[model samples]
Target: MHRQYVVNLSRIREVERRFKGELFLVMDDQEQTMVPVSRRNAPAVRRALQI
Candidate 1:
């Protein structure tokens, strides 16, 4: 079985701050896990996060 988790944008910003504004592929504090961001979704993610 596989498990999935949802993280909020605010958390993402926290991670970005921890990484010094780098959000390409970050490990959020809540999960402390790194998930790969696909090339297709990269732009959308950046736009949503405003990074």
Candidate 2:
């Protein structure tokens, strides 16, 4: 069996731009994991975050 955990968008603390226009979103949670965003999806992701 598998389980999926969802983090609220409101917990995003920082958005870092990576190489080749990639992005990393830092969530201010207990683990503080960095979620990568593809270059092609950066625009849409930014729009959703309203950054």
Candidate 3:
């Protein structure tokens, strides 16, 4: 089944530190996922999230 999750942009943490690379970290139900993103396209992601 296909499902969709609505994530709060404010809740997502953006990490740009060394060894981590550029990513959007989303944590829920004690589980977390790091979504890789490019610096050039970051603004688009933010816009899509309505942040």
lDDT for model 3: 0.51
Worst 10 residues of 1 by lDDT: 13-22
Ranking by TM-score: 2, 1, 3
Per-residue alpha-carbon lDDT of candidate 1 for residues 1-51, written as tens digits (9 for 90 to 100): 012435566655332322433344455567666654544655677787676
Q: Please give, for residues 1-51, the per-residue lDDT of candidate 3 as tens digits.
A: 002444555666553333544545454434565545566665676577665
Q: Estimate each model's TM-score.
A: 0.50, 0.71, 0.42
- What residue pairs are clashing in model 3? none
Q: List the global CA lDDT of all models.
A: 0.50, 0.73, 0.51
TM-score for candidate 1, please give it.
0.50
Model 2 lDDT tens row, 1-51: 001334467888999887777788888988988887766667877898888
Regions of candidate 3 where Cα sits further than 4 Å from its true position: 1-23, 27-30
Highest lDDT model number: 2
User: How much RMSD separates candidate 1 from the native structure?
Assistant: 6.3
